[model samples]
Target: MAELSENSSGYGGMKQVFTISLALFIIFLDGSIVNIALPSIIKEYSTDLGMASWIINAYVITVAVFLVFMGKIGDMLGRAKFYNIGLVMFMLSSFFCALSTNVEMLILFRFFQGISGAIVIPTSMGLVRTAVPPEKVGSAMGVWGAVGGLAIAIGPALGGVITEVSDWRWMFYINLPVITIALFLNKRIFQHLREKTQPLHFDVWGTITLSVTLFVLIYTVTKGPDVGWMSWPIIGGFTFSILGVGVFYWIEHKISYPLVDFELFTNKLYVVGLISNLLGGILLAGMMMILPILLTEAMEFTSLQAAYFITPLSAAMLITAPVTGRLIDRFGFFVPMIIGYIISVIGFYLLTSLELNTPTLSILWRIGVIGVGIAMIAVTSLTVSTVSVQSSQSSVASGIFAMVRNVGGAIGVSLFVSVIMTSFNHFSMVSIQDSIQQIHSTSLSTYEKSKLTDALKAQQVSFFDRNYTSHLESLEISKNNLGEWKKMISDLRDQEQKNKVTAIHYAFIFGMLLSIFFSISAMFLLKKSFRL
Candidate 1:
């Protein structure tokens, strides 16, 4: 392999950056685009919330677990070879995902799609480091980050329009064209830049232990609500996960070439950057997952309307990312990260005030605040992870950073969904029980009281079993009881809506607390005098 010049500059260098950035852009775009389509997917499959969530979780977990290993492979063999291969695999997986007829099939394909993404993301970052001169690496990273932000900006709206006019399947099909362009550009730019290959021992056991740890941990969190939280399976899953983590750590410490380099942990700057990235992912993914559901279910907005409302979050990110990159280059990551955290905390605080009747503009501005805050943290954290390491280790560092972020996203989606569902069920059941007690105190015949009580009791399981209104409509009521039944159903519906709003409000509160913790951690971890 020829040495890359420190003064490397020309059309070729710019083209290389653009090509790598475009590849990453699509990877991020895919993640955001699916949130808008989740409701439609659930309806089509008639799946419950737990099952519907797997559509996101399965992909995220697969990517998070495989990223480090794939990144190491790219370093050992050739990044360009794997990068191009990943593009092709991603395209094929997208096609299969579109063709899937069942939720199970879709999840399986999404898992494959995630594997391809793991290959592409780290390699793209590695390629960027190779393409640019050392002095201009920050600027090149700025362009990369900006493009990723742009992808997120358009993803929801694009998905909404596709799902509205065509089918949700079209969203998957749409990837084909974009990926084709990436493949073409990849071939043109990376052909001569391939690094010489070397044979190395792969850390297969370390990979397995780490994957098992994450999968079990995430699975337990996601399924705890459905099966009783104290059930044997959940208990066993947690025990296994804890043990797996210990084993994985031991294995990594013993290995010469570990999946994750433990040496990176010694770098305070790198560690803080990772912590910021993890927290950012949790907030960002949680917000994206819940907002669409809130809009469509609680506020009665169409998918397109919800997408339009959520656009500001990513739009703010797109606008802020480039500037954040430059700010990191000049003032270092500490200033931008601290400011970003404070802003995000405020955004989440405002989100806790959300009501069923909150106006669209109000929601827009709140999420927009979050977008700016997260963008600063996200861009800064990524730059820190890559540049803090030796250029030779850029791929591995990139992989570790991405792995933490995606793991946070998987956990966030699982945790938020569990919280909202459990809270909604608790609130709804209490309201129903109170309503039953009120009816019992009224002057009514024994038969009438018995009938009404049974109807309300049926609704105790309504949150998980079936639609509340549909279950009510299936009940038999006498002519004399029709008016009472209608009033009772209407009131229950109102209570259900209130319960959803309250549940979502609690999730925001959780996000706000996380932001505050992230802010405090950054302050303690990075000294006031430290820069970069």
Candidate 2:
């Protein structure tokens, strides 16, 4: 394939850049918007945490599995052709997602949506690199990258307004107009771009071996709290996931065309950059997971309110990341990464103040600081990953970076939800036990005390034994005194609400721990620009 020098078609080079950037923005915007809207979906569907999590995990895990596979297909086939297919597939899936009646259906469609996303990401980048001259490639990519960062920054707020102002379905629907415009421009822009098909070997065993393992593993982790961790379902998922990963590593090493070459881990920069990538996923996914719970469940903010409150963080990132990226070109990686992570750590520490009455302003600056920190880390780490390898192997860097980031996101969201739910359940049980003990010690008559104890036992036992809330109405108590038990039920509900507050607090802490670890690791990254 000949390089597309500074050749001008009907649309100039910048128009092509705009089309690709819009596509990137469309994908990233959906990712953040969905996070803001998740709590509504959970409340509306009456689904449990594990079930609701699949709304996120299903898309991320599927994307992670398909990214490299699709990238290879892009190389073997036509890049622009697959990219257009991705656009159509994503639009259709988005429409179907709006039509979903159940959580399962929504998640199923989102999985398809992710496959479309996997196709678009690498192809879009490849297309941009082809259309722009070598000197201008970085500038075009910067614009492409900036749109993504901006989308991430504003998605929460935008999704909130969409959910609050209209319906959550509108978030998916919103993409149609944007995609329509991008597709219209991209058709002409992509025409001038040439596809260089390569003779590539398919890593069949490696792809299957790994995808199955990750799916099972993530499924297990997400459901561990809902189903007992030790239950056959959970245990089986972990068993297979673990065994699958082990097999995947072996298969990749043995195959001629490995999915992930173990040999790359030998490079110091690659190793460090990977750590940052995985942590980046955990940070993004974990914060998105817990913040909704905080805003909607604990702080009693509407989706829109939470989105507005969090906008500053993204704004800070939008403003700072580009400048930080420039710093990586001048001062090298070490200073920027260290400064970024340090601010992020401070931001996380401030977030420990997340309680029912915590003011919105406190959250804004704290999260903003963390965002500023990430701005520095995100660009620097990408630079590090690409620089760690030969220029020829830069595509490998992109693949590995996407793989870790998505896989880590899937794991992070699952882990955060599991930890939060597990923590909340523990708190709920303890509160329940204390209430029962208080009842036992009350100076009521013997028969009265006995009746209350038995009734409480029946209620708790019924609640745990059955899956539905209808079980609460079926408790064994005097039918005549049903109204009298209303006070007790109210008390239980209050206790449950308090337990939720505590759970969200702990989830924030868990997220902070991830940020702190990532910040610390950023200190050791090579203090140099990428060779490319």
Against the true structure, whose TM-score is highest?
1
**Model 2 Cα lDDT, one tens digit per residue, 371-403:** 776666665665566556543344444666667
lDDT per residue for candidate 1 within 20-45, as digits (tens), equals 88778878787777867887999999
Q: Which number leads on lDDT? A: 1
Model 2 ranges with Cα > 4 A deviation: 1-18, 32-58, 78-81, 96-109, 125-146, 149-156, 167-169, 187-195, 230-232, 390-392, 433-443, 446-498, 526-532
lDDT of each: 0.79, 0.70
Candidate 2's error at 305, in angstroms? 3.2
Query: Lowest-scoring 10 consecutive residues by lDDT in candidate 1?
Result: 1-10
